[model samples]
Target chain A: MASPHANPSPRASRSNRATTVHLRLRKEIVSGHYPQGSALAEPVLAEHFHTSRAPVREALIALEREGLVSFEKTGRTRVRTIEAKDIREIMEARAALESMAAGLANRNWTAADTALIARNIDAQANVQSLAELSRLDIDLHHHVMLRSGNTRLLQLWEPLRWQYEAYLVEIFKRQAKEDYRPETDTIPSHRKLLKALSSGTPAEATQVMMEHVLFNMTWAN
Target chain B: MASPHANPSPRASRSNRATTVHLRLRKEIVSGHYPQGSALAEPVLAEHFHTSRAPVREALIALEREGLVSFEKTGRTRVRTIEAKDIREIMEARAALESMAAGLANRNWTAADTALIARNIDAQANVQSLAELSRLDIDLHHHVMLRSGNTRLLQLWEPLRWQYEAYLVEIFKRQAKEDYRPETDTIPSHRKLLKALSSGTPAEATQVMMEHVLFNMTWAN
Candidate 1:
């Protein structure tokens, strides 16, 4: 899942000030910089963003809807705590969605698609840290999702990705350095998937993709 | 595809006014009452909802993030239009998730679970109108998803449901009266699914559920 509030370059140009506030606050909440259950003071946020309380209030409400933050009437808004159950549920959902995407991509993949996937895998192989590996992993999955030509799938999957990324970041920071190594032979699976796609059997491709997602689910959990 | 905004009493009390506004607008969009690409006027909505512009504006922003609404800086917000491609992608994703949910529910269900699902299906069969039937259809799916015991699956599957519901409402409204006949025989499929779940073979349940979803997709499209 990408950051709900990452606010890529394009967003700045097209979005209003309220959206900008949403993006920044979303970043903070998902990244754990705000910490779980920590109160978000509207006046303080307004001061920090150099905007009025109205937009900040709006931003908090937006974040609340995304499951990133929560607020009580006449009370403060706070970052929602990430729980194990939440992570497990997210991973399961990812397993379903990504497996489907992989299946579609596999059935549709041309030689060019295979080459692109192979390159992504190679890039993953060179990552030195869990953080870099994590980033590459997201990019690779995104590549497959995009290649599947499933816009709704992309939208559905994106928020979960953002939450999972936050969790992974925390996990990376806490785990031993030796745990960060990328699987050296991961490219074979992508290659296999590509081969299955090239065979033009969506069923076979779906099966391979399912296994791929299950593998990630195991590791992420 | 149960209403994402369905307060259901419990959620209503827990949520603030802003949350309610967000959900009401979301419900409107998902129900297709606000047509795709229709402009949302801030003052008009505020007046209609008997709320201030602040909450209404916040609600629109939240909707934008959910892919149900869109806005440009210095322009009015509009109901987001979903294309055929969007529907296709959503259907594909739904197939994947719901199939997995079926499999999971099958593996996890007790005898009581089977009984409960059977009851839900029976309830669905009792609906008298197309609109009521649609609500029951959504409920049946929701029951299956909840029984699947995957929170992520529910979360991920919901937005797709909302969007699909919007489409279904459009199709339902257009179809001739004869086309709206309730499927009295469809309960058997639910029974079969229950039997599969009771047997604790997730794979079998998954297959059945996939077929069930595909069957609906064929007619729905």
Candidate 2:
């Protein structure tokens, strides 16, 4: 007889299997397809992903480390519940990390960096909905981290991005019926930061960046 | 014939099985027992832990999330190499986050808080050896983060303690033979910080904390 948790036959190229499984499960979790506190069994996930339990198990663990899931020492596996406090904590961390990134980007930015930021700003300006605007906002922050030239900073902040994106999606979906503006005025501050970077005053840039981050945090609240 | 990656027999308890495997493997990777870039096989790890591939697989995935290992599509996992750049980025982030935590701790600290900090400082004063001193130093920082009342900050900085510990141990081992009294002298700064916290001047404490972090960052150089 086959084992209760027998491995599924492999169905995909192994090279991208992990990434594929990770993305699929991540999307399911973030999109609210999987209700909070749902059980995520390894054998079940493997069957869903058409892969062995090995990769699916790894994906869930990755999600746990990313603060997207929690685990307990039960005989079976389960998905952890997301709490408001967790969301708040993630927001606070994002504010601090992003503020630092923005400040560093301001201080170290070149003309080319300014040009890239300008393009992002323009793209964001053209976006109509809060969802589009939020995605652009993420891209803008990513641009800053990339320009800041801090690889570790980027890595430290990367895991939080998915959660942030989920939160943004949730908030935007709730406010979809309301009139939402594109936040075009925030571009002026970004421009000022660019000026500070060009002048080589990281301190001033950092202050501006702090204000920018605080502003976003308040908006989230 | 038994499959190469298949478990030959079943286990009695699977709950502690995963945690036990995870802790053992994490210890090996964290202690540098596994050489960097060394491949970690699921079957091999399962056999060594006297468990099935399921729990061992889960542990490896968790390790990957912690940056202790990297999984590739080639159906193999390896210990991640710690790069100088990675260290530097982590330090930069630590500097910013810890500085913020210190500032908040200072602002919110009551007389009781001051007493706790002072106690830790006094404990550090009695410690011998650079390693013990380093451990106390981290404990002090952890205490500060806890006192800051920012749960998010604590969670964000949690995983980083491992990297910090590893770096500290390496640096302390190297500087043990040399006269590094100046580093020890920095202890007084912690005292000064406590005084600032008692005085309710968070700005001053934040400045001092930033300097303290920057000072530690210089150690790796």
Candidate 3:
């Protein structure tokens, strides 16, 4: 008898396939390929993934849950539109989550974890492109959450991943549009945050992390 | 011809029905009527709600998105099981979000807003049941978020509502099991938080809020 799933592999899990498709779609949306408010057609996605509509639909629903997309009453979906207010709210939310993550990381930091984060920060200072810079920014924050020894905190932070990507893209785009030169002063805050994390006090680390996360609130200006 | 929606009301919006059902179901799940890891059958819930399966499924999806439930690959849904690690993560996330909300509230606080929050705090002083206290606790935090004038912050805070309720219930349950008396000193921190909020400085308010939130980490003793 044949399997009932849209795409079935003996060794692969059903969710992994859906996740792969979801990540691809999320990347497209975050990278601005499927610009804000653009319709995401199910059949087209299914064809692109070389699968049935079931997995495509599942991917869309996952993205919808993450605030990267929205569905209409008629079951049609579109990328979520980012507004000025959303940008502010996203920053505020990041400040809270990342600051908390930093405190937890301080409480649970291992020598290896500190070295890993320091390496990311060092690489961050020499990133080649805006996209790489954006990825390193995410990497540093994600590493903090991972080192926090709190899996739930990381899970709570998962939904906002696309928002982080969207925000970074917006920042780089705005700066480029204004023909502004790259700012080198941003790394000092990260360096200070690293110093605070090594301070062995949760309060100190959290305070610096909160301020650093919110520091870019003035970036658009 | 009849409408295809679960509640085919000419006046009631489909989304409104979903919201109503969602809120009720969330309350039930949070209050422990629908225990963690319990299966949520869609058809039965639809019949209970006196509607088609559409709205019940929609409500379930919304709950799932909120992390209150999870859907399996077999098309079955179950309440998420809260683990010890999850509790810690949830508390950390709450501290971050609420502290940020407090800072935002300080920036946007009005005389009327202060009056409203004060009333909630006053009510908190005399709450008769753990359930009521939990509700009031949520209400106070929610009011702060509302006063922040950031709708996105409120939306971001919504998914963690059930976790807050669960944490409160766990605290109360553990205390009861130990036949412990209530602590009278807890109110002082809240009072201090209120004073800090009214201190007219964002840094002062944010610092107090962060400390006040993390104060409970040692409360179980």
Give the best candidate by DockQ: 2
Q: Please give, for residues B97-202, the per-residue lDDT of candidate 2 as tens digits.
A: 7877877887678878777777778877676666677777788889888987887678777667766665555545445654446335757777776776678477
Task: Between candidates 2 and 3, name the one with more favorable DockQ.
Answer: 2
Per-residue CA lDDT of model 1 for B1-221, tens digit only, reads 25644433443422355578888888877777887788899999988887667668767766776667777654568887776566776678888899889888766677777777677777766767777777767777787788888876887777777777777676665674544545554667667767777774778888887787767766666
How do the predictions measure up, each by TM-score? 0.84, 0.83, 0.83
**What ranking of all candidate models by DockQ puts the best one first?**
2, 1, 3
| Least accurate 10 contiguous residues by lDDT in model 3 chain B | B5-14
iRMSD value for model 1: 4.0
Model 1's DockQ?
A: 0.40
Runs in model 2 deviating more than 4 A are A1-15, A35-44, A72-87, A183-185, A198-200, B1-15, B32-44, B71-78, B81-85, B172-175, B182-184
TM-score of 1: 0.84
**In model 2 chain B, where is the ten-residue run with the lowest total lDDT?**
B7-16
The deviation in Å at residue A165 for candidate 3 is 1.2
Model 3 residue B28 distance off true place after TM-score fit, in angstroms:
1.8
Tens digits of per-residue lDDT, candidate 1, A160-202, equal 7778877776666567455654665455666676667666577
